[model samples]
Target chain A: MKTKERSSENKICPLEVAVNSISGKWKVPIVWQINEGKKRPSEFLRGIAKVDRRVLNQQLKEMEQDGILTKVSFNELPPRVEYSLTELGEKLVTILWMLNDWGKLMIPAEED
Target chain B: MKTKERSSENKICPLEVAVNSISGKWKVPIVWQINEGKKRPSEFLRGIAKVDRRVLNQQLKEMEQDGILTKVSFNELPPRVEYSLTELGEKLVTILWMLNDWGKLMIPAEED
Candidate 1:
């Protein structure tokens, strides 16, 4: 039933697509969290402050669907699942690093 | 009274700060519009689709406060106003271009 990854539009705006891909506040944090080696959902909960399981899972699911993350589930007693960033996700990290640099510019030297 | 620029947190996460700086949907378009030589609000209204004046002004005000844009008012009969990107704003444009390129990768070649 689900042939297309995301909804198709006549005139797709790439910027909008980019913005929509990482729309939620939790997303960037989640991406950074993955890059920082917080793989499992439990690890994510511990790393990111105030994010509940349900919401965290939801964001993770969306990211996976968007091809930014790849999730693996192992059949264990406790059930273990880990997520890794794809090539597309890695490219996003590069952009985010640049954004972090830009964000630093907004901070005054005295403040830092 | 308002001396400080934007709110200062003790531990400023530059990534969070960067994401927060461009939270709204209209901001990227607004930046692009300005770059395309749409200087005034009236011009912005025509350039960006489905954006009302109030919302546009709100986004513009926030961008200006963030130092991404500088607003100028001309003393005339009909009143004239213009907005231009600051050096920082120009920096943002460079990043946005990268984001746009990253965005292109998400689109399938056949679809595009």
Candidate 2:
């Protein structure tokens, strides 16, 4: 895949770029599933409760394009494919955990 | 502020919650501005390029609702206000830095 085209500004905010990379509706959950060792599309389909196949595919392709995922297609009888988090993707998972923790603090404690 | 209403599901994904909190167009920029010690609305306006006052106000309100910022009003003749990152908001800054690092990896190296 080609390097992402830089924006018009000579200086780009890496934080914005990072946020944009995972902006898709299903991107976070997709990363979660893949991080959990669910590699194939079918596995991802089952792992993320409400994602449709087409949308899932689109996010997967975008993640691949962004270098967050590495896709391998096995030219076997059924044409098997697998996805894994690239180094960047793994780094994001660590950050995502931090975000999840931040989110938990916002959630109200359960009261009867 | 009232705790955020829980979604339909008995369980909520904290990662999604965290992502949604910062989903607004000017949120990250707003955070960056506040992080850099720009406390007032006018200061944020000057710090974030291309953001209008109205949109900036809306995003600031949402971030406040999400507990990412604390807003205080001083009812003086001049009407003063200030904003600061809460503890949760401070945690987000740490995570944002990590995301920034990850994003830097995706940016193409400059070539002569």
Give per-residue CA lDDT, model 1, range B1-112, as digits (tens): 3555445533678888888988887999999999988899999999888999999999999999999999999999799999999999999999999999989988777744
| Tens digits of per-residue lDDT for model 2, A1-112 | 2345434443788888898998888999899999998999999998888889999999999999999999999999989999999988898899899989988898887676
The sequence of per-residue lDDT tens digits that candidate 1 reaches over residues A1-112 is 5555445533677877888899876899999999998888988899888898989999999989888999999999899999999999999999999999999999777744
Error of 1 at B10 (Å): 5.3
Question: What are the RMSD figures for all models against the true structure?
Answer: 4.5, 4.5
Candidate 2 residues B7-103, lDDT tens each? 4443688888899998788898888888998999999888888899989888999999889999999999899999999988898898889989888
Worst 10 residues of 2 chain B by lDDT: B1-10
Instruction: Give DockQ: model 2.
Output: 0.75
* Alpha carbon deviation, residue A41, candidate 1 (Å): 0.8
Q: Show model 1 residue runs off by greater than 4 Å.
A: A1-10, B1-10
Best by DockQ: 2
Best by lDDT: 1
